[model samples]
Target: MSVDEFCRFCHKNLKIKGVFSQSTKIFEKTSNAKTVFDRLIDLGLTLKRSPEKSIRTCRRCTSILSRIERDLPVFRKWEEEEKQSDSSEQASAPKAADQSNWDPPASKMPRRVLHKFWPNPPAPNQTRISMSARRSITEVMTHYPSSKTVCNVCHPDDAGIVNNISKKNWKTAAGLMMRHKDLVEEIKVKILELVQHECKTLCNPSQGFILWRSSPEDLKSFSFSSLESDLNRLSPFLLSIFSTATNHSLPSTCAAAAIAVRGREPRMSAFSYYLNSILLHGGARKAVFKKLSKMAITTTHCHAVGKLKEFPHTCGEGLQLLEVQKEVLPTSGADGLTDSAGQDDEGIDLGGAIGTHRQRDSQLKHDLVDSSGSQAGQMCQEKRQKRRQEQSTQEEEGAEWVSRKRLRSEVQPSPLRLVVDCSFDSLMMFKDVRKLHKQIQRCYAENRRTLHPVQFYLTSLGGQLKQNMDETDKGWVNWKDITIKTEHYHEVIPREELVYLTSDSPNVLTELDDTKAYVIGGLVDHNHHKGISFERAKELGIQHAQLPLESFVKMNSRKVLAVNHVFEIILAYMEMGDWQEAFFTVLSQRNGAVPVDQNGQAVEDKEDDDSDRESDGTNTVKDNTSSMPDQQEGANEQIEAK
Candidate 1:
């Protein structure tokens, strides 16, 4: 009998079915597996197998081991190269001199070092300087050259100052200092001020260079009243860079300064990258355009910027233009027709007054004018027909326009209630909150466009998420078939009717029930808070379920869908009455979702592997054992007995 054990590498506990036995034959089939086995042996991991106790590994640990095995050789080579370079540098470097035996030259020595070597002799009637003042003076002198010439700040007279204060020059030093007593005192104060400034600069370097090395606080303190003058001082090229980086909305000098300092580097913000995308889409040359793109900034890869323009904002403007065109075109056509009729009447009057040959020529000219008019009319009719054909084609392709009044009156809302629990606001960061708000807006927009919009409920809506929604989507309060509340879902609806939809749920939902209120967690944590929604549902004692994603389709990545994506999928299914079609229509190609057969295999892969099924006898035998009814019944009997 085989017993379940923890994985040898990751130490993850695996059940009997999940355990993968470690065998030399299996290792030989994978690339670099032998090397990984040897490395594990070197690290004191036991791989010896026995009849009673066999070595086992989990699937995740096996995959990770394979990846490490493939990359280990490159890492080893890099380490060896680094060691060789370090050894070479050490071999060619000069040795340091013995500090006890060597000394710097007297002329180039620091004043602080000179003071350490020699001491001023004590004398009667000599005023003693403070230790702090002496230290300040020593600091100032360290930067200047050691010379006998008098410093103008210290000594204004043409007398030489004492550089070497020996016994012979002790009287000379005292006399020189006494002669410029007031000047020396004044210079000492100035030296202290200089040292203080240097210390301040060392403490906070941003203050010393306000323009180039400014901190966020310093930038924020800039006066907006002088913004115009400050902007004038900046070159047009720099201003243009800032303008493009901020999407042409330079709010204040602080924002401008932030861009000047931080925007030079790549991957500064999402707004910058969005601007870069806009420039690229607008036909800007890639080589010349250097703002927030990876080619220039090199921090992030390509990302999808969802909904580049707001639908309602742009759609309203387009409808207004259409209305204006409708009003102007008819009036212009009527005026042109009246002008043509008046010209025809004048031509008739001229024909009566002409001679026989002139009248004949005039009649020919009139006939030519009538033919031209008919030709113009035919061209106009053809254009109108073409326009009508385009409109009909658009309608056939499902681009038919729906008026707001008709949409509100005709389409009936779906019976199924969809609740978005926004109580997870505390779990997400500021940026995640904003992203959640955007997704909620997209959900609302999608529901409005769909024929059968669900009864939408936004519960526990407050905090930063509420503020963002209020600022961007003011009309959400007046939306039909929607309910906004500040209470939890449990308080709003009965626990029996609530069904939390989370990816971590064990129960799979094949189809939605009209009696049940489905709850989607209105949180965007980028997968950080895994199993949170499921745990919450369990704590609340409500039923929890996940979409039947794995049963219907094989995904190349994780089966986590966005909030709007889940909402849209529900709406799609409600309209189409098929899960496969709904998933296919809502999920983009990037998701890599492929429909699977009843055997739990990808359709394409299954088709390709049909010919090799007989050759792969071991896999076929294992599948048979798993699918055997007798074995399944025996396993169930053991479970019931336990």
Candidate 2:
């Protein structure tokens, strides 16, 4: 049992020279494998240990030492079992394998019992590391989960749970915020505080210095409950950062701001939400528009001034040249005064300068060459006029070109524009869902206790849809709406599993139809209905004109797909609706029928509870549609200052 044989045979000829050197502390100072193994043996252990003689003969001492240290628990267990089995023989057994059988009898009962209680170990040749230890390493390295129950030690709270869910378990992470309200609020507060402090510090000499100084790792390590919570707080700061940078281009500045603010939050959605928030706030929106207007004016002036500089130098030099032409015209005297004047039709008139008769007649006889020069001068004037006309046309064209390709203008549409990528049918459904979410949030904010189950579903679905739309580059995809004429107790299914459902009829409206209704908005905020499937989910879907499944497996999958899509659309619609309200208030001085508060500004509020809308409204039950005739009058006139 010498260390040399174990190192040479078992260690695959591995070397341990630097940190594992013979004189290094692992081998010399801290006690070697032989010490640990011998200690266990001295405690009446059955496991064999390399004595000092055996240790001294070892070739690769560090490897043998490490192996023995790692296996100490196993050896300790075997020793205990042996002692408990036969108290007398445990003292006499010198060879390590003598007391404990390394290859115990393979009985069916024992194997069955082991199988029932424990997972099978990794094959001997396949793994040198313990499976549990490997899993720990994996959890440490990854930002996501890998199994049903992640190591709770690695994830103490919902933040850890969310971090692992995307990679290891999407189901757990997707709805994490709904489940962990307290944690979500705590995270939201921290982020808001950070953002507010960062924004206010812009007045300092070292403005934006904190963002530049803080490492991304440190920022991400800050607790985050959900992506949306992070966006609500962090977005304003990110947009402000770009807006404040004087010389930075908008696109580059926005990108840098996005990176700087990206931590535990999903960076892409955060970017979109942040930009949207800027558009929502009146001051930020005004600042952006002002900059754009100034830019356009400055560019136009520069170009126009440049073209003006190209105008010909004409006043003094032209008069002198014309004087010479007048003298020459009379010298070619074969024609009368009238004929010569007609022949010199293109010549400039010297009549206005001929105040005195002497000066006029002094246009004395001149040579043929001067007469020809006068004609040539006339040609030059004609050419210059034509060039000016062409230049004017080109200038107009150039202005048009610049207008089309301006820097900020290119990126402007990306932020301010709302694109609906889903099918007509789905979009209509989304609209209903969005309205529901808004109503729910208004209720929640107002401290209303109860919400109809249908209303809750609609609100919660809206939030989910919004999240999905924000997650993708293209935003949302259109699907035909499920329209049913008759109601039935149809089985409900998830949206995804219904991918193969019947296509729209030839008469059905496609997404391309201009008149198609869009899923304008929604919110997935109902917290109490977690995990409860809606009644007749599958049957309801089918009755609502969803296609039948091929088998039970397909039916369940289709149900799930349908549900997921519905939820995703719900999320997208709700947030978009929130932004829509915010944007309307900023741009139009009216957000549907939402009333202004005492501060003379539209209440820039979130619809957290259903009652919030009614309480906040100066005229309770004010219309919430932008389409009503005289909508502006309703918002401005309906609410008197109180």
Candidate 3:
């Protein structure tokens, strides 16, 4: 009997307890019982007592009925007014008009108004059709047959569902099922596999992976205005596989599948669309460029944003002047006259005068030899001696000026010296080395931008680090105010003047010591070689110190910053004279750096509590370090591990 019973309201099986079948008992116990009873009456249930069968309702329906009972009265009044108006309108219609010619007035009730009365109304066929039309392109595409043949690796069930989808009026089928999330994921997997397979067939890894290249004639064909356009322009092989897996000929579906594959294996596709887009539309933010690089949408931030080609001409000119001084001063040594003559000849050649200077010198020497006995020859000899004396005096004066300039630069040096100790070259991978080179370039750019830039020394610059810089960034060597040396920092600068900056050091730098050269280890080990810099500093017996990061700010990540970031922070402090401002300015919010007071409380939190503390007449501060001893210890241990 219980198995046969069902809820009269929801039509669900009444297998559980708490069934409310008796109207008399329900009205007595439940609030808003009259509305519930009236609803049951509207459902055609009689109030007469019947022992054989009664209106059974499940617990879920009972709860819902009770909850909606309060709104039922308003709905009923509105419904009654609508019914009376409809009846009056029907009666007013012309009796002579044919019944077929008169169409019933459209329902005036809003969808929400109907929902209050019938919460779970059954969906009509037309509503279902409209909803299917409104579904996403991917969902709509699952019902269409693929233009290309399905891959052998495709699941049989997926293939069958795709095949069964009719080309015309698929909505007419009563038993057809749509693919769900699992099916979509399977399609994505199949697409990736096919892409890899195709790549294996067409690509050679040793030769490098370039999916497609646009020729001069085909440049117009490669438009990156939208994903659809990009998809339409994808390589024929990729397009075919993506369309087959997604079971649609639409460019959007193929593009989505290709994007999914690219996310998994970035190097599989050339991403010509994204690359071209970045190139054509430049000046994107650094974070945007970085995000694109991380997504593998672009190769590198510098390349994507065109920063690699921006050379500081002022710095280059200064370096060129210094180089000329060094070259000229060295040539003015013991064989000064001969070297001066050679240089004069070279200068004449460079000036497009070619053999004129050499011919004049030869003619003068021949005249001096031939007219040795004549008064004119004696006069010529005296004139030549006088000219030689004048030339020697001029050369001496020029050498003295160069020496004085060199002495002034050496005596003053820069107030602050920034040394990048690039000794850990063997520890870095190829990609890390590339990243280090980019950071070094940025450091140079930052230094050159300032009015009083510090002297930058890149020491121990050999091995792969040197090779990458030489190949990619040739301007580094000629950059002004920078010294690139292949020897160790100790060999270049005195050990007494060297003060290494490492994250693991116990000593915190309170101020910038201009007298001592601050050394930053030029190693990008990706946290693989933790404390290596500090250890090297200790072994070399150089004073090591770390930036006062713990006192000024709190980082969401480890305090270990990139080389350029550290350099920029130092430069910022030198200009602003405030460590906190420098940290905030140099460290991006993306790094999760939050400003904190000297007490280690966040600035925002401190500001909010300042008024409360002032009103209370108490300046007592809570010592969080004392409260969370265990946490602090754990953090210290973690830092040590890192």
Candidate 4:
């Protein structure tokens, strides 16, 4: 039976109807209207009193409520046949007594046809991953299917169904790598042969060199299967293009490193394993991070690109774009976007200036002490001179005042010093080291794009790479814009002066004043090293500031985020001046965790998997290398030599 729905606010009976079912499954005749989050202000009962749980609409609140997806009603559409049969049964039935005998015939039908279409049975219930784990994966990447086993393309559990990777696709990627590698070597060798002075001339921030590598002919000629099959031999070339401009010449400026390649590989590879050894030896060299996805990142806003059918440049969000071939066209900076925002201020200032000039003219006519002669008197001339001098002086002072204010506001009293506390407890293990490397690489990338790149200090000096490191093997590659001191961060920055920005602290980072320099721990201890950062901070007596996460938005996942993700969030917040805006810009609706209000108690990480699929992009290390078999032989040997 249809029941009238009423808004608690207007108390008006809506067109919406609620067929009361013992089950939560929604019946027909409910209206879906736009819902708003009134931010828990005294905006009445339309929104709730608590900010987090306040997503209510006293009106027709259908699927309008967001963030909390489980709150949405499960609608079951009533079929036309069901309606007809019910009507016929009512007409044919004798009375209310016979109505018990008459069951709705259509109710026997299943809501969704199952088993008829060939497929496996419904999956059994799964143990939910912890919120911290969800967040770690979310931080470094866009959504990939739950790849529990090996890649479907590489070793398909089932034939005829590809899980986003194919053999031929690997061939294309490998082909591109080979061609790029060949071209780079050729260019560099040719330069060495021809020029004597500086081969560094090819180096640029925005290098516009596109190679038609991976063309139809090249793909056909190359043994892609062999390359894909034997990744160890092929990976070094990919690494060259991906991470460094060393062995291969990667253009300094590229929009994306788009890999419209087919094929899937495991998350852990020979690349990461070998990388771990290198770090253990020389200490983590140019830190590293990956992935295949459609990426549309403008300098301002990063979002999903529309369908490829509608727009051609929009390679699927899953496809990673190349660095040189950037995803976005250059647009005016934030200043241009808000040029009109300051219009009112300009208008007021202009009006004030005009009024002041009028007042000065009036004073000249009235405030003159003496004017005796018909032909312009000496007093009049003196008054005019005085007025002109005053006007000039006033204008000069106003200009100086504005310049001074702008300098104070824009110029830094002290530039924000960001630290990478690489000095973690020594026996931390392998996987965490890899994750830490990925974090470092990501921070470097984020800093490159920051409006004012932060001064990065990579502290905790001693390790393997430092032992026999040559003069040429040092400094961050192609990142002159950023001040990153590996081990040297302490030379300039005192350890005591550093304030840790970690989740361990209770102090929410509401504002960043010109005073304290912030530091992010370089260790990825998983949850195994929980509160290590906080403990370290406490022991050192360095003040700590946690990100204002719960204060700003509701999250389901754990508060801990990847190093680069945190840095980018801070940079985004600094640029936009809003925590919410910065959070949304970097974190997607699905992958990002939002916490709800819970009586000041410790917020539980619920078994919610709904938002796990949403992602901004792949957060994998851009080391330009993928993984290999975990126990690839000679891994130790290779690290020892390199």
Best by lDDT: 3
Which ranges of candidate 2 are over 4 A from the true structure?
1-202, 205-463, 466-642
In model 1, the runs with Cα more than 4 Å from the true position are: 1-409, 610-642
Query: Tell me, what's the RMSD of every candidate?
Result: 28.8, 32.3, 26.2, 36.2
lDDT of 4 by residue, 1-642 (tens): 112232222223343344322211122223463224331121122332432121123322332223223321222233555677878997998768555676554322232321121122223475432111211111112345775444222211122112212445665544443434345577677655543222121221132111122222221222323333232232334333433543333322121121211112122121222222222233221222112121211100111111101111222222222211112111111211111122121111101111354564453333222322333566677888987787788888884322212332353322676777777726456545655665676777677655656666666644432321222235445545455445543455776677788787878888876456788876665456778889878887778888887765564445677677677887888778888778767765454344344443223333222233343346332331232232222232121000
Q: How many clashes in each candidate?
A: 1, 73, 0, 52
The number of clashing residue pairs in model 3 is 0
Q: After superposition, how far is residue 187 of candidate 4 from its true place, in Å?
A: 45
lDDT of each: 0.57, 0.33, 0.58, 0.42
Please list the residue runs of candidate 4 whose C-alpha ends up more than 4 Å from where it truly belongs after superposition.
1-414, 461-478, 484-491, 595-642
Listed in order, each prediction's TM-score against the native is 0.36, 0.16, 0.34, 0.29
RMSD to native, candidate 2: 32.3
Q: What are the per-residue Cα lDDT tens digits for candidate 1 across 122-240?
A: 36677643211222121113234555444233221313343424336777766666556566787778766754554333234333333332222222233333333344344334445
lDDT of candidate 4? 0.42
Preferred candidate (TM-score higher): 3 or 4: 3
What is the C-alpha lDDT profile of model 2 across 1-642, one tens digit per residue? 223322322222123542223322212334333453454343332333334212221334435445555665686677678667765675666658565666664332234323322234446476333111212322334245544443433433344464656478767664665446576787779778977665444323243322332222222222222222333344555455555683545545544554444332222232332232223222233355344334321112222212112211222221111123122111111110111222332354332333444443343222222444656667877898987777788788874322322353243111111112121123334444454434333322221111111111121232434544344323123312222111111222233222212212112211121221221112122222222222222333421122111111111111222222332322333334442332232223342434444443434343333456557556455444554556544433321100
Error of 4 at 200 (Å): 34
